[model samples]
Target: MTDTLNAKNHSIEKYLRQDRMPHIWCSGCGIGPAVSCFLRAIDRAEIDPNKIALVSGIGCTGRVAGYVKLDSFHTTHGRAIPFATGLKLAKPELKAVVFSGDGDLVAIGGNHLIHAARRNIDMTVICVNNFNYGMTGGQVGPTSPLEARTTTTPYGNFEPPFNLPYLASASGASYVARWTVLHLRELERAITEAMIKPGFSFIDVIAPCPPIYGRMNKMPLPMDSMHYYQEKTIIRHGADPKEADITLNGPILAGTFVDIERPTFQDQLNHISSKVNAQV
Candidate 1:
């Protein structure tokens, strides 16, 4: 009873900038759950909130920076990764995080995403994938599954959706995982693991955009989307990322695909610096 009342009394109030209350996220939007999980992960991991620097690009998910009670940046569309890269390089001790939507991170910012992973930058990237550009009129986007309908793709999306897990794995992320908003506990744990891990860590959070993408794609109700995720999700740890492509109503692969130790960009830079100093 006490725990329930405490939570009712706004337990999560501390992590949020209350002045920004009444967030813009729509009812039934999965972004709220994803953010809640991230906050819980920080608490569970016992991370010093002050030591974290969050960066977000222009999109629905980008608003996370404004709400989080921490040092954060709301950068231009598709520039979140580069900003985070600079922050990580300048302050290697502080954990850099990039929180953005599919369109902002993997669409115009796709180049930055792959290069950061390739360099193994010490940062965490949380990508909220709602299959379409939820905020911007629900257009078909890079992550829109094949044949999925959107405002732009009224009939169906012919272009093959980017297999995010495979792309991240191939580009060389140190840690990668995918989870639906329905898997609350697993999602929280994954965020915690990603935050604690070194090198470029990426999380693909498959979420629902009920009024727009979901309604257009036949998941008119939020519960419809939730049921679909519950029924279709496949938990396969260490599975090959190549086979984790998400098609319309296909088996959704959810798990950590990559968790390997690799030299981060900072480590390489330091090594070269040390070598140059030895010759000097």
Candidate 2:
């Protein structure tokens, strides 16, 4: 058993800070699988791990940076995007990736998300949406389905959740996609594509918060949530983003809703600078 465990560890150790083993995530937490998919995607993309910088804010998913062996930053809450933006601008050669949870990215840092997308910044954002803030006592988040129960919304949530794909598309992201943790292959493929894409890319991962969100919503087990995802997910590769809004126990449209080319912030700036210099 020890040999088997060590062998399994050896396979993934190259991408992880093995000294930080025994991560704090709960059993059956989707974050583990999501992170695994990301590592695999990076390998598949064949980019030098040293050239990739991972940035994450405060949340369960934010802990990803701490565990990753690559250059990573665990930034202040709701500030991962801005930090990543600065990193990308300062070191354009490095591939900056923002990996964080829904509440940290969409609720407290929503303005940053929209503006970053609008500017077509060169970066990839992987948002794990578990319906609530899993780390901080499971409070209701911006992506929580309407009528879903959370710690703050004990009775049930009434506010509408953000249609992440629609938001990403409307904000001018060059690449946008969504998938659940259960869809490992698809999620990894999306990540791999995003890594190679030029402008802002966003992938919304619908993960499971079984310990809190699940228990409150009649899905106490992680497998139950996975089953729910399997049953509800509808793969539509080119569906309209506006119709991808997720409702409680409703069909979830997952796919690459948007993939278009646009000049990145750096690209536009360079062009303007060259023109000004030529005129001068």
Candidate 3:
């Protein structure tokens, strides 16, 4: 408890394990910013880090579980949500957060994502979509845009990428937001909001993997990636899901895409309990 208190009073750097000084991520990977933003979000929430449980799936982003000095679980690939769902149900007071990758969540774990949203599970999911399977040596992922080159897509990717924010919103996520690593402040705020939200909250962080993924797509440098996001990104408030497709290239079109009050899983269960207890 004292340690958590100290972490709150002092900088998040105090909470980080200096012994784990050099992370395993590549030189220009955006995972570093993602982690930093998450820590900032945690600080902004003013919630005890001890009470937060981080659940992650197998991927580059999944490695976050080991880095954060909290109750963390590095679960199987694409199973972070189900594991988190169980954890939230067992301990409703704890803040359950899922950290996964584009391939980990949208590809293999697509079903889990939607089901969790449908249940309105009280958990926050922050997925880092670098547009390729970076951990696996830059393979084509579900979020990889058309014409993007990958290991598998040597010529050019033909299939359309899933508009993650729109998908999440339509799938019933109570809170949905999208932001690139370049927009660190907004990303931090979105993460904080998602963590505090009572229902399923999903954030698609468009990060850049300069080494493996970006190198293949001609975005080999971190600065180039950042500049790309800066020029292409359009930060808006209260964006409509319907307009997302029409303005894909015009602006990154990121903001609180969807936020609506819904009966959380715990709320429904408690309501049923109250009714039964009344009758008894």
TM-score against native, each model: 0.96, 0.97, 0.92
Residue lDDT tens for model 2, 133-238: 9999999999999999998999999999999999999999999999999999999999999999999999999998899999999999989999999999999998
Error of 3 at 192 (Å): 1.3
TM-score of model 2 relative to the true fold?
0.97
Clashes of 2: 0
Between prediction 1 and prediction 2, the one with superior TM-score is: 2
Report the Cα lDDT for candidate 3: 0.86
Tens-digit lDDT track for model 1 on 35-100?
Answer: 999988888878999999999999899999999898999999999999999898788889898999
Each prediction's RMSD to truth? 1.9, 1.2, 4.2
Please report the TM-score between candidate 1 and the true structure.
Answer: 0.96
Model 3 Cα lDDT, one tens digit per residue, 1-280? 3344344554667556666767888887888898898988888999899899999999999988888777999999999999999998888889999998989999999999998998899999999988888888888888888888889999988888888888888888999998889889989999998988889999988888889877887888988788888898777778886555422233577788888999998999999999999999
What overall lDDT goes with each candidate model? 0.93, 0.94, 0.86
The top-ranked prediction according to lDDT is 2
